[model samples]
Structures are given as C-alpha cells and as structure tokens.
Target: MASLGVFISCTSDAKKTNDKAKTVTAAGDTVATPEAEVGTVREPVDTAKYDALVKKMANGDTTGNWAGRKGPYPLAGAILPFKRIVVYYGNLHSKKMGALGEYAPKEMWSRLNQEVKHWEKADPSTPVQPGVHYIASVASGTPGTDGMYINRMGDKQIDSVLKIAKMQNAIVFLDIQVGLSTIQKELPRLEKYLKLPHVHLGIDPEFSMKDGSKPGKKIGTYDAADINYCSDFLAKLVRANNLPPKVFVVHRFTRKMVTNYKNIKLRPEVQVVMHMDGWGEPDLKIGTYRHFIFPEPVQFTGFKLFYKNDLKKAPNRLMTPEDLLKLKPVPMYIQYQ
Candidate 1:
C-alpha cells in the first residue's frame, strides 16, 4: 500500500478516437510503413556487457538476490542497466496527479531534461533515457457507466503525450490503475498504442482494488498470476510484430501490492521492473524500498520520487540522482511525479 497522498483526478473521455497517431502518416499525407513491419532490429546480447550489467544491477548485494537468474537474457533492444530511464509520470488532465500534467509541455520537458542530466552526471557509466509515463486508465472515486471506478484516456490524449515524448525521443509508458476492472479488460483496448515501438507499459497495483472496494478506500493487490498475464501478453506482441523487447513496469510500495513474487514469470521479450512508489520523507521512502522492493528479486528495479509529496515532512528535499545511486541494486528506471 502507498504511504501516500496524491489526488487522482481524471477527466478524459472514455470513448476512444479513430485517428491514427502521428507516426502513421508522413508530411505528404502518405501512409508510412508501419514500425512493426520495418523493425527487425533485435541485437544479440554480448556476454561481457551482460555480466557487467548484472554486477551493476546487484549494486553490492551480499544476499545475492539481484541480477535475478530468471527467464533469459533480455531480447535485443532492451533498455535497462545499459541506459537508465528517467521519466515524468502523471495525467495531462489533472495537475494533482503528477508532474507530467502539472506543468506545460515545454516546462515539463525542460524540468525532465534537468533530472535526466543529473542522472547522466551521477552515473557517467550508464547513460540516461528520457521518458513520459502517462496514466492511461485512472482509478476514480465514482463508478462510471461500466460500474468501474476508472476513467480511461482515449487515443487522442495518448497521442498528445506521445508528441511530447518525441521531443526528446523519450520512451513512453502507459500506466494503468485498474480500479474495479481487471487487466484482461483494460490492456487489450490500449493494444494499438502498446504496439508502437517507442511505447512501453506500467501497471499500478496500488489502485488495483480486486476486492470490490472503491479506489483510494484501500490499497489493492495483484498476484503473480496477474503479472504473468501482462508479461505473456507483451511477449506475444513482440513475437508477432517482430518488434524489440518491451519494458513492463509494475508499481509496488507494500508486500501485499504484489504477492507471490517468485511465480511472476519473465520472458526475453519483456523486461519487468518492480517500482517502489510510496511517498514520504527520505528515510521513510528508503525504508519502504528496502522492505518491500529490495528483498524480493525482480528482473529490474525502479524508484519513484514525488516532487511535492516527498518533501512534505522534514529533510524537505527530493532524492538526488547521486543520493539514489547509493542504493543497493541501483534503480535502472527513475520516475518523477
């Protein structure tokens, strides 16, 4: 559960749009060759680099839990220890949701780039990859017509986020807050966007409310079965489309958020990141990561820093990249809200 406070205000229309994303057309209005068909760019893994990455991922883990020996080497084009992902996370409709929607696109990208540079400088060895994590399905307070307390963002909104991310060639992660809905229902509708090469995925167990409880009433949970379903879904996409491996991020702050960690299967076509997403002072946040995240061995690790919620208490400051680099199994994916 999140030791947190952030209003998840969602106002986007649930109806999806029919227009093609910017990627589908050229300036002359000519239909471009789809990325999925043209992308046969899976590079074979190098053993030496893989070993070094495993070492960096371990970050001096005496327990030998990290650099998990799960599945297989990430299929070609996986972005992880080779490149640190720095992302702005939020919804475009509500400033309360996160930094991605709190500022203008220009201002947000500028601020995002600053942190990207910080990570780049802090760990000169691992370059930073910029990204935008948009909340595609926001858990809501009231159940809509579908009886699910969630507002789903249509293609138009997702396209706007894509345009912003393209500014820096940043990757995009569509985050889902399932509310009363299940992953089976939510993920398929967004397949058009997920099929895009530059786009990835994030599933928040924080808002997964599986027990018919309203969102924000209680923290929710996702069993390893839920996670395997998502990973399997992505792996099939990779094989069918011949696209590179996709990065799959799962948010967690408490052990209950993600149960049966060992049973969450992995694949070469998908890289799983168990992201620590609680908000509090530095000490509390660190403790949350150590207790809930570090102990369980996931494929890769991610850390989320709330720009506002994190500094509400003493030691009123954000965790700098330098400060975070000290963490065991240093986070390969860093998100700012």
Candidate 2:
C-alpha cells in the first residue's frame, strides 16, 4: 500500500512514449527508452580505466577527486564513491506493486542492469549502484489472527530476492509496510536476513495504522521515536556481526508520511535515507522533492520512479537520470517500481 498519488492513473502512455523514444538498452535490446535526452554528449567512457580507478579508491588511494562524493556513509563495508544508486523494487509475484514484479526474475535483472548502465553512461563520474528492494511485509486490509494488519512474505520469497541480488552482485532491501503491526512486531522477523551483510531495510509510512484504521483508508505516519528505534536496532546488528553500516530508508512523499523530522537521529552503524515515493508528472515530482524531501534533510536522500503510475497523465514526461541528478542535494538512491 502507498500514498494516493501512487494509484492515480493507469494509462499506457509511458509505453507509447517509450516506443517513440526508440532508445536502445545497454544489453543491446531495445526495451523501454529514456524519457529525455541528456545534455552532455561525450566520448564513450574508458571502462577499463574506470574500473581501475574504482579499485584504487577501494584500496584507500584517495589522491584524485571523484565526481559526486564517495560516501562518508558506508554501505556493505566499502565507501562507495558514486552518489547514484538505481534500485528496482517489487516482489516477483505481485502485480499491484510495480514493474519489478511484472516480469520474470531473470528478465527483471536484465532490465535493472539496463538502468544501471544508463546511469553509468549518463553521469560517467557517478557510477550507479544497483539494488533490489523487496516489499517483504505487505499491508493487509484486515487484521490477522495476531491483530497485525501486515502480511509477511514467506522465507522462500525473501530468499528468492536475495539469490537474485547476489546474481547482480547488488545489495538487497527488505521493505516493510506495517498496517496495524508495530515496528517492534514486524522488524524482528527479518533479523535473519538483516544479519546478511548485503541486506538492508526500508519502511513505508503510508500503511502504518497509527490510529487503528485499515491500511489504505488514510495516510499513516512514523514519528522520530519510531525511526530512532529502528536505527538503534540495526546499529546493534551491525556491531554484533562486524558488518558494514546498514542503510535504513523511509518512504515519504507527503509531509505527514514522516513526522518530527528534526528529531530523527543518525548513527555510525545506520544510514537513514528519506526517499520520495510519490508518482506523477515530472514537474510534480520535482516539486514534491523540493517541498517535501529537499527542505527536510536526512543522512541521505532517495527518489522513486513508478513505471506505470508515473505515466498516468496525458502529455506527461518522466524524469531522466540527468534531470534527477540536477536536484539540490541530488538523491543518492533511486528506486524504480
């Protein structure tokens, strides 16, 4: 379950726009195309040189300045130099959620690689980090026998995403949408997965039933206390396992999706990202980011793209990688649904 903007339009204009663009994919397949033309056109990047630079940076060679910033924030043990992270979000079996779930797993990975490569070419200095974000706990309309309005995905389902993430050499995020369930009740169930070095966590406030209403009846909220609780939880795990700092993302588009922003604390072992998850035309999205996400700062920031919902309006255009990169405090994490 997500904000009302997420469910707005269901037109196939995005596909029509894709056809008109006739853009080629990195894998040599002409799949969905980029929405806008990038301004900078340069010689094809010397990837071998790029890879060598990456290796040097990994070895603690910090002589040259890199584009964007090598994170002071550590994800998966390495201080990733690039600020761009392109993530595909959804479950393999669900249709209501997104395009990540619309295709088979292998096909999905192929598409994800295409986006990753697109960002790599668009901003040669900031190589995109690929990730798979699975909605592990779905919000339910009815409270279950345990009185929790969240339905946890089976272990096999979680493992499937993990396996695919490993195939891409990418990180994995288990997203939670707590309906009536408290974070205390739902978070521990994913501890086994969280223990894995590459696995991170995401929480959606849209379905958080703070007032005992159903999941989709009204927009929900999570205060700073709740965020602090989750960060403390992850910090413990990071220290206990000697793993890198965990990436904790909170999904928001509306101001109310997350409350008491001033009080949200940061931890050495946890990187908090305030992700903009609203869907609409390009201008609306930028405005949403500017008003809701930009002014309120966090450890890091993320933006989400909805394959279908983003194109619901007629005469609409999607935001290109370059377009999003231009945002103030440019989003470090990018998710596609």
Candidate 3:
C-alpha cells in the first residue's frame, strides 16, 4: 500500500509551477528549477499538409482506417509521423517491471540511447524522438482497501521519472493499469503533471479488469467508450492550457482488449496510438501485429519490445529497428520494457 504522503505533494513548491509549460521535477523537500519548454510545442499542425502526411504514415496500407475519420484537426505541435518516438517502459519500484526499473540510471540511459541511434540509422527519414514511459498505476496481486487492486504511484514517483527525462529534453509518458477501476477515476488524478506539454499518457487494457475479476487471473478489456473518455479528457486539458498535442497510447495484444475500433473518436488535441503490446519470438510477434493491430487502424501505431521475454526461448532474439520498419504502416511510436 502507498503511504499517506502519496496523495499529498512531495514538496511545498511542486504545485506552484504545475500549470505552466515550465514545471519542475520534485526533489526531496524541494522542486527543481522551472523546466525549459521541450519539444515543438507551439508550431501549429499544418492542415495544408496534414492529409499527405497521414497518407505517407499509412505506408501503403489500403485499409480505409488510415487517418480514421478525425473529429478535430490537430493543434500545433503534433509529433506523429514527423518523428518516431522510441520509449523505455516500466515501473520505478520493481526491477522486474521493465528496463526503466531493471538497470541503474546510468546503464538504462546508455542502453536507451543505443536504441535511439539504431532507429535513427535504420530510418534516416524520420528523426528519432526519445521518451520514458512510466507505469503510474500498477495492477497489484491483491485487492486494496478500495477494492481496485491498483497501486497508484504519487508525486514523488512521477517526479523521479520526469527528472530523468529533463536531462535529454525527452518526452514522458504516465501509463495506467486500472485493474477494477475505470479510466474516469484514474486519469484526473494526474492532471497536474499532464497539463505540461511534454508529459503524455498511455492506458493498458490487459489489466483493466472491467468485469470485476483479479487483474492477473485474466486479460481485461476496454471498449471504444473507455478510450473516448481518455481522449476527451486529454483534449480538454490541451485546449485549456494551449499546450502541444498529447500522444495517447492504448496497449493491445488481442482483439477483445480494444473493442469497436471504428467508434473511437480522435481530436486535434490528442494523438491516439494503438500499440501492439504482445511479446514472443519474431514470427509470433509479427503475426500479432498483423492480425490484431494492422487490420483495425487507429490514428497511429506503436510496437512494444520486451527486453527479457522476447529472448526467453530458442532462436530467441529481439526485433531490430530494421525489422519493424518493414511492416506495413510502420510504427511511429516504439516502446521497450
């Protein structure tokens, strides 16, 4: 269980600079200096060239879902096809959670930087964007007092990751695994940080547990409505703050994990990525992306690589940037855990 301090601010000044683009990372009892604006936040999305870019992002997919009938023209600072985002995903508390937790800070950054170079070399046309994806809401083994079975990481936990990303001027993603809770209840809690331009969001449907079962006992699901709720939530924040577009990520490995793909709405303020979160040998992983992710297109596509799980068996190997770029509608958002 989290301590009482988890709900409270870690530092007195943490909340003071939150609503601006220049927020700070919390450190012990004080916050760091105000953050410099990161990423291309103010440049408006060009409607004159938007359609051509989305078509290029399609990479020859004949499916009618490429751009997916958008509900809003994107605001300035959309970073989808313009540059590929390579991210490290994990929870900070446990090493087993992912690469972010498995290695010391120095080693983790070295490994991540190596990946950024790999993708850049493989696809020179699309510059690589660095990002850190932290699991802000983890699905726990036992039900907590609220019966949500979720372990919510608070101000200190989030501040730690933000501090690290600040070094490279990289983006930060706060992911959610709702367990028995709903998106409506969980997302609003992080508004203080989400209001910033560089901090984005990701939702894992595998642990959603919509039917009231324990999180790990079975894979969970999220319908188009749940996804729409998050999009609307982030969209409102963007309009209110005049910040850059937030890249909203949805994790998927199965068809049921995300239902009614056609009904999920897109807004100018939010860029939705339907990420392939499955893990396996090359062939199996490729099949999962083709069967589940490729067929029903969202606004953007992302691929997740498992550092350990992908190499567990014979012929074990990780997929290289060159390997992923070969797919139809190449994934613009790449995640490693």
Q: Which candidate comes out best when scored by TM-score?
A: 1
Rank order by TM-score, top first? 1, 3, 2
Can you give the TM-score per candidate against the true fold? Answer: 0.90, 0.78, 0.88
In the order shown, the candidates' Cα RMSDs to the true structure are 5.9, 13.0, 5.8
CA lDDT of every candidate: 0.81, 0.70, 0.80
lDDT of 1 by residue, 1-337 (tens): 2321233433321233344334452122322222222534445777578778878778788887875454688877777657888999988888777888889999998999898888878889898888999998888877889988888887778878877877777788998889999998999988867777778999999888899998998999999999999999999987776667899999999999999999989898999999989888888889999999989887888999987888888767888988888888888899998
Winner on TM-score between 2 and 3 is 3
| Candidate 2 per-residue C-alpha lDDT over 1-337 given as tens digits, one digit per residue, 9 for 90 to 100 | 2532222221011111222223232234332212121221223334455444444322242333222233333433432333456788886656667656768878888988988888888778776668889888878766667777667788767776766776666778899888888887789988877866667899999888899987888899999999999998999987776566677889998998889988987776787888998889999899998788767766567889887788899877777888876766567788998
- Collision count of model 3: 2
Q: Which consecutive 10 residues in model 2 have the weakest lDDT in total?
A: 8-17
Query: How big is the positional error of residue 249 in model 1, measured in Å on the Cα after superposition?
Result: 0.5
Number of backbone collisions per candidate, in order? 0, 0, 2
Candidate 1 TM-score, true structure as reference: 0.90
- Once fitted onto the true fold, the runs of candidate 2 whose alpha carbons sit more than 4 angstroms away are 1-83
